[model samples]
Target: MTILLMLVQIIVLFVLVMLHVAYATYFERKIIGHMQVRLGPMQVGWHGLLQPIADGIKSFFKEDIIPEQADRPTFMAAPIICLVAMMTSLAVLPFAKGWVLADINIGLLFIFAMSSLASYGVVLAGWASNSKFSFLGGLRSMAQVISYEIAMGLSLVGVMLMSGSLNLTQIVEAQGNSILGMYLLPQCIGFFVFFISMLAETNRVPFDLPEAETELVSGYCTEYSGMRYAIFFMAEYIGMMVMAAIGTVCFLGGWNGPFAVPFFPPLWFLLKIYLFMFIFIWIRATLPRYRYDQLMDLGWKLLIPLALVNIVVTACLKAMIG
Candidate 1:
């Protein structure tokens, strides 16, 4: 029975994640469409509710293409690697009390490690494609991912310091009793750094230089098509959801609400995630893509230093309090 229950939970979580990824694409299109003064996807279903399903079906049936010179094995493995890495990060996120896939002590570090692994997929995909644009995209992805990852990891140190544990649940618990209960308030600087880094980590605009359509013709996945391309897309969206979930867990107090309003904590969590997703879409619509040089400079010069400062301040406060 215990094993059966665990299987059920895994199935449910898998379905939920996939549904979220599918709808996220639809949501992005609708939001961006409205921003540009156009009605989006009303033809598929009401407000294009069925659009994602149609897209999934179309991609599955479409011809899978490989460039003549492409390395077939690595090319196929790349998207799977990307998707799996992102999904693995979700295991440690606590949706509500007693509602996590793995309640391990090193949950935070596990997530960070898994997130870092995702870059390999981009790098491999680009290299395997044997295209100049793909190669350049892969190079950019590697540099950008590593640069932002430093800031991203450093930003979380502040949370770890205050929470006194690497466990994500403990981090959320630590926020429950303070005047500025949520880490978002006291660690505002860290939150800012992490939030910006989240955009970079997920390769969302204006940091989407890896797939900058105009310059690199879809970036690292330039040679991909059909379901292979869809896997890349799925991985991208799942990465976005993971980043949003991390933001909710680390900074916003995952499943923490004002009162135990029965059946509402998950709702709160979802709301926070959607809010971040909206910001992601909003920024994409409002900001033009950053130049490659400018993006690199911002990550290295601005975000990294800010994240370091946040860690320093947080550590000092913890020491003084102790």
Candidate 2:
């Protein structure tokens, strides 16, 4: 019965996540469309509500093309690797009390490990495509992911220190009694660094050098088509969701709400996630992509040191208070 319940939960979360991904694309287009004073996907369903479904169908029936010079097996495996890594990370996120798929002690570490694994998909996809543009994009992506990932992980170390545990649930609980009841207040610098790193981690605008369409013609997925391309898209959205979830869990007090609203912790969590998603879209619409060199410099010279200092300051403050 426990196993059945776990399986059911997994399936339900999977469906919800897939739906979220589909709608996220629609949401992005709608938001960006309105921002640019144009209608987006008005012909599909009501206000283009069904556009994601239409796109899914189109992708399914599209021809799967393998480039003559491409490494067929790795090219195919890359997207699968990307999708699986993102999906697996969701298992450890606690939506609310007793609502996690896996209440692992090392939940935070698991998420970091999974996110790091996701970069392999882009790297392999670019390498296996055997295109100069794709290869260059892949190299850029690897460097970016590796650079930002260090700061991203370090930023969270402050939370782990304050909470005195690696479990995500405990981290949330720890925030309930902290100053301002959220890690964001005390770890503001870390939060800022992590938030920017999240943008880079998900390959969102302002940091989307890897797939700069104008420059690299879709980057790592240049040679991909049909369902393969769909998988890449799916992985991208899932990564966005995962990053939002992490932001909620680490900084904004995951599922934490006022005592007056204790009955609906999940609502607060969802609200925070949606807000982050909106920020993601808003930035995508507003910011220009950063030059690759500028991006690398920001990640290494600025964010990383800020994250380290935030961790040090947080630890000192916690010890002083204790």
Candidate 3:
């Protein structure tokens, strides 16, 4: 019975996440459109509310085009690998009090591992495509992820040290149920580094060198089309949401708000994720992509060092308090 219940929960979570992934695209288009003083997607069902549904249907029906010289097996598997890894990370996220798919002790580490694994899909897609542009994009993604992943992991060391647990739920509980109890106050430097690293990790604007169309013709997944392409798209949005959720859980105090919604426990948690999502979209609309050299320099020379310093400081604080 317990196993059956878990299976049901997993299916529901998958459905909800996929729906969120679909609508995230619509939301980004609308937000960016209004940012640029335009009405976005007005033609698709009531101010573009149904646009995501249309997109999913269109992607499903489109021809699955494979490059003539592409490695068939790896090319086919790459997007699935990316999508599956991102989706798996969703299982460990604490949506609200007592509301998590997997409340394991090493949930945080598991997410990091899954994120690292997602980069392999990008690299494999690039290599398997047998296209120069795709190869370059894949190489770029590999290097970018390697650099930023370090910074991102280090940035959260402070959170783990302070909370004294690797479990996501425990981290939230350690913060207490108050707006003032959030780690955002003491870990400002770590948060700054983490935010920048998060942008680079997800390949968002100002750091989106991996798929710079102007340079690499759509980067790693350039040869992909139709449903496979949609899967990659879905994976990226899911990655964004997952990173945002981690930030909310670690720094912003997950589900902690001034008032509670009786009917919805995760409302505050969802709101924090939205807040992070809004900033992500806002950055995309505002900033231009960084040069490859600049991106590398920012990650290694700046963000990583900042993250290390944050760790040292956090350690000192922890020792003194103890």
Model 2 alpha-carbon drift over 4 Å, by segment: 259-264
Better of 1 and 3 by TM-score: 3
What's the C-alpha lDDT at position 160 in model 3? 92
Q: What is the lDDT of residue 243 in candidate 2?
A: 91
TM-score of 3: 0.98
Q: What is the C-alpha RMSD of each candidate to the true structure, in Å?
A: 1.1, 1.2, 1.1
**lDDT for each candidate structure:** 0.90, 0.91, 0.94
Q: What is the lDDT of residue 65 in candidate 3?
A: 94
Residue-wise C-alpha lDDT for candidate 3, range 1-72, written one tens digit per residue: 989999999999888888888888888999999999999898889998999999999999999999999999
Stretches of candidate 1 exceeding 4 Å from the true structure: none
lDDT of 3: 0.94
lDDT string for model 2 (171-248, tens) is 888889777678888788888999999999999999999999999999999999999999999999999988998889
In terms of TM-score, which candidate is stronger, 2 or 3?
A: 3
Estimate the overall C-alpha local distance difference test score of candidate 1.
Answer: 0.90
Candidate order by lDDT, decreasing, is: 3, 2, 1
List model 1 lDDT by residue over 1-322, tens digit each: 9889988999999998999989999989999999999988899988799999999999999999999999999999999999899988888989887789899999989988988889999999999999999999999999999999999999999888888899988888888876555888888999999998999999998899998998899889999999999998988898898889889988888877766657555877888899999999999999988998998899899988998898888888878988
TM-score for predicted model 2 compared with the true structure: 0.97
Error of 3 at 102 (Å): 0.8
| Highest-lDDT candidate | 3
